[model samples]
Target: MNRQDDLVAEGEPEKEFNPGIAARLPRKTVAGGALIRDPAGRILFLEPTYKPTLDIPGGIAEYDESPYDACRREVQEEIGLDREIGALLVVDWVPVLGPWTDALAFIFDGGILDDDQLTLDPTEVRTAQFLTLTEATPRLRPSMTRRLALAQQALTTGHPSYADFGRDS
Candidate 1:
């Protein structure tokens, strides 16, 4: 098993993370998301088959896969597009659901590729689209909602604010 598959035991019972709570919950897993933008500055998002909420095109890092690699891979799988990842935008702790592990979230600014040539992976992606912040803000997942809020605030006001991605946080 690679680092992404490694579980860091929490000295407590596993908690269901559907409706996430961060009140002193132990963090668990490392995951990343691609903040992909089209030439017109539209962000690409997907509606997961398992959870039909709008979200960035990325997922957990794979064995021997760098966080950057994972980000790119997730986008390619979910959005059916190639990407160029930029600097790290955010790094926060994530709480694992039903197990012990830490999810370190790495957000990156990603550049997009030829839209006509993309091919989504059926096993991972359900549906995808490019949306402006005005459109995407209301459709994101709960965690992504928080992150988007923070990111928007930071962009508009230059305040240093961010959200924790873990189920615990």
Candidate 2:
């Protein structure tokens, strides 16, 4: 007898997979970001019109979209850059805070930007500029500052990093 039939014959109840149960499982929000750097090694930050703090060129992934694809799409949509996204540098599991849900945030390497003029989406990005990590630290939210630092470390070491709410875990 097949394994399933044998199990039943052995007086063991047959176990069945339930798609409906799986479908009803809780889901976390996902966001993707690009770690774009200038020739001087300064990281790029966007002053988003919708948010008070400066942020990287990225946004929430659309339904069913991979984080890598979301990063590329967000870079293009937010800053009008169609550059290739490189290795994933960081994956941060952020806990729920205030109005935000717990989320998985992915940061990908976006190679160097050598004098390519940026065309910021006026509706989304108010301005874009390159800043040294120290200069950026104060402008970014605490979690983002930590995430950016880890991403930079990953880029330098050629390895990925994981974090819990941007703290290395």
Candidate 3:
């Protein structure tokens, strides 16, 4: 498992009370975004402050914000740069969460306007660097790393995702 998986595995699942649907769906939620910036096909990832692993810059989404907006905010907060989040990437569910933990991720095509302006949030992010997907394959959350494999296959072929048609991890 690379760094991002460590964050979830570290048992620090941050929960927020969604007052919007608290009455209908009465479960605390944990939401976040994953920013994938492929400048020249090289991906950027963040090394978390409290953990020793790397992850795409993102964090828990606020109640009032859309997941897409949360993702962009996360990238800005973690990298201190502006980005354009592109297509919808992945929507996943945490099987073990006490609440309905569904994650919606958007994969944005981003360009570096100012590389020198990158900075990590002290409370959540730590370091930010760009690496090729080949370099990133070995340094991602298990689900993401596995997802990377599927993404590679999709790049070679035209299939979208094999997230459900694979060997169990």
Candidate 4:
């Protein structure tokens, strides 16, 4: 007998299959952005329209898009800088401590930008400017200041670095 006939003859009930929701695991947000420098070696910052704090050029990645690509795209969209991103400078795992969920944030090396190429979209970015680390420190949020410090260290050491909420992980 065929497999179906054999099963029927054995008086065994057929099993019905249901593909319900798959198991859910704790999820973390992945955001990617870059620390761009100008010809003067000053870091770039975007004045965001939505938030009062200055931000590096980047945003949350869309579904299935790599974080690296997301960073490149965000730089182009936010600041109108269509340049290739360089080495990975920092990968920070920021834990969930407040309203935001846990996040894996990436900071890529955005090679120096020429003066003429600087552009901004006022709807998303009010302005863009380069600032020395000391100048940027007071303007950046605490976590961002930590990420920037680590990225600078990585650049100096010629090695990629990782951190968990500002502490080495």
Candidate 5:
């Protein structure tokens, strides 16, 4: 008897293909950033050489790293600021329809930094500046403005905030 005929005579049930595990969707990208403040009450903005937009002091989280840890690491790597990150401020869900999926961004509170403490990394950051909301308004993208607004609110209210790319109130 052939292999198929022998199996049928052995009284063993056929093994059905189960594709359950492979059907799961990929997880969204996770990134962490920091909203650092100065004694003048202005927010810190990093001038990234790679992008026109003024970014906060943070970057993407590595696998197995917590959001807070990623924030600290980014700050240290990008600006050489070795400091403790405060409570989480805002979590923004940003969507991209192309090659990448959506992103879950966490903006954490980086306590005030003095002028002398900053050590900028020339490769990632060109220069750093402190700007008020009004001054920063024109520089940031619409989504970034909304996220920053929510982050400032979280700081004032001592609570975390969320936003769905400025869609959800």
Candidate 6:
């Protein structure tokens, strides 16, 4: 028998690849964010015009775009900063809740900023500021708080962390 037909279960036919079949496979949403800190170690947070709570500088990845590239794109779009995105800090798997689908979120190191001016996108962001963890906790959603903590830990340890629903796993 030829190499293409070798040992095909002795009698079964080989199946050809199908794009339609592949398109129906399960998929997850991906998002990326940057963990930017000020020289005094305060984290940067953005008040989104569409959302009630504060968020980091990032957004959902576009179709066929990589998480790292998404981070870079979002940072520039959201904060008007083209700083280099550094190492991956944390990856959190968020479960389906309410109107939101399950998603994989990534946080990358954005290094420290001393006096970088940020020009916010008026349609997307209302304001951006640096706040201490203690001051930021109340402004952020619970899951975001946990994710931020894990990202900070990863930065301190020079390692990456995995989380489920923002809890370390």
**Quality of model 2 by C-alpha lDDT:** 0.91
Clashing pairs in 6: none
Expressed as tens digits, the lDDT of each residue in 1-169 for candidate 3 is 9556876789964465675554586443444455354546556777788766677776667876666677788878887765776544444443443444544333333333434567667787766777866787666666666554544444445444423222222
Can you write out model 4's per-residue Cα lDDT over 1-169, one digit (the tens) per residue? Answer: 7657866888965454544323355767898989888888788998899988888898888877778989999888888878889999999998887788999999999888776576687789988888987897787878888888888888899998899886666
lDDT of each: 0.66, 0.91, 0.58, 0.85, 0.86, 0.91
How far residue 114's Cα lies from its native spot in candidate 5, in Å, is 2.1
Per-residue alpha-carbon lDDT of model 1 for 1-169, expressed as tens digits? 6553454343455776754676667534566787666777677777777666777878888766778888888877776667677766666665655555756777776655445555777776677788886787667656666665554344445443445672223
For model 2, residues 1-169, the per-residue Cα lDDT tens digits are 7656866778963464774676688898998899999999999999999989999998899998888889899999998989899999999999988988899999999999997989999999999999998998888889999999999999989999999989998
Q: Which residue ranges in model 4 land beyond 4 Å of their true spot? A: 1-23
Candidate 3 C-alpha error for residue 48, in Å? 0.6
lDDT of 1 at 140: 66
Worst lDDT window (10 residues) for model 5?
14-23
C-alpha-based local distance difference test score of model 1:
0.66
Q: Which residue runs does candidate 1 get wrong by more than 4 Å?
A: 1-27, 96-102, 112-116, 149-162, 165-169
The better candidate by lDDT, 3 or 4, is 4
RMSD for each of the candidates: 9.2, 7.6, 11.5, 10.1, 11.3, 7.4
What's the TM-score of every candidate structure?
0.64, 0.88, 0.62, 0.83, 0.83, 0.88
Model 3 vs. true fold: TM: 0.62
Which segments of model 2 are wrong by more than 4 Å? Answer: 1-19
